[model samples]
Structure formats: structure tokens, C-alpha cells
Target: MKLLIRNLSRATTEAELQAMFESFGAVQSCNLVKDKTTNKSKGFGFVQMVKNGEAKAAMKTLNGKDVDGFKIRVKRAEDKPTEQPLQDAE
Candidate 1:
């Protein structure tokens, strides 16, 4: 299951997130969005867990919990809309 984590501390690292989520279960992936120019964290990230049950448990227990001085929000990630390829004008 894919989970979205929000309002993370600016100083939080991907390793920290992985470690935190790992307490509940195996984390398949932990990604922290970073700025293209400055390469700084966007204060949010996504975590992919091996199982839905573990993801739910992590979300239920971690939501609104303080981590690295921030009250983090965790939930199932919304499905992104698929983009249609643009047709070139003749």
C-alpha cells in the first residue's frame, strides 16, 4: 500500500522516515520530494509498505503524531489521474 505523509519537519530525512515506518512493518520505499533547484525537502513524502494492514496500522498510529518537531499527517495516497497524450495540430 502506498501512503502519503505530510507536514514533515524540514530536517527530516528519508532514512528517518523509513526507520519510523519500519517500526510498524516493512517499508518498500520512502521518498521525500525535493526541489529541483535547491534540492531541499518539500516537507512531504510518500511511503510504500509491503502490506495494506501494516500501512493502515502505521497511518492510524502515526497521524497527528509529533515527529522531528512536526505533527505529521499520514493516509493512503490518492490515485493520481492518468494524463492523456497531447495530439499535435496538423
Candidate 2:
């Protein structure tokens, strides 16, 4: 399951984030969003867990939990809707 983590501290590292979720279960992947120009953390990231149950557990325990002096928000990542191209009027 893919989970979105928000409100993270700028100092938080991807390894730290992975460790946090690893406590719950195996983490498939961990990523921290970064700025293209400065290459700094965007204060948010995504974590993918191997199991849904573990993901749920992590979300339940980590959501609104303070880490690195900031309360983080965790939830299942939603799939973005596909865009439709414009059509000329008849």
C-alpha cells in the first residue's frame, strides 16, 4: 500500500522516515519529496509498505505523531484522476 506522509520536518531524512515505518513492518520503498532547484526536502514524502495491514497500522500510529518537532500526517495515497483533452464544439 502506498501512504502519503505530510507535515514532516525539513530536517527529516528518507532513512529516518523508513526506520519509523520499518518498526511496523517491511517497507517496500521510502521517498522524500525535494525541491528541484535547492534539492531540499519539501516537508512531505511517500512510503510504500509491502502489506496493507502494516500500512494501516503505521498510518494509525504515525498520523498526527510528532517527529522532528513537527506533527506528521499519514494516509493512503489516492490515485490522481486522468486528465481529459478538450474537444471543439459541434
Candidate with best TM-score: 2
Q: Give all candidates' CA lDDT scores.
A: 0.97, 0.98
Residue range 5-79, candidate 1, lDDT tens digits: 999997999999999999999999999999999999999999999999999999999999999789999999999
lDDT of 2 by residue, 1-90 (tens): 999999999999999999999999999999999999999999999999999999999999999999978999999999888998989999
* lDDT comparing candidate 2 with the true structure: 0.98
Could you give the C-alpha RMSD of every candidate to the true structure, in order shown?
2.2, 0.9
TM-score of 2: 0.94
Best by lDDT: 2
TM-score for each of the candidates: 0.91, 0.94
Show how many residue pairs clash in every candidate, following the order shown: 0, 0
Off by over 4 Å in 1: 85-90
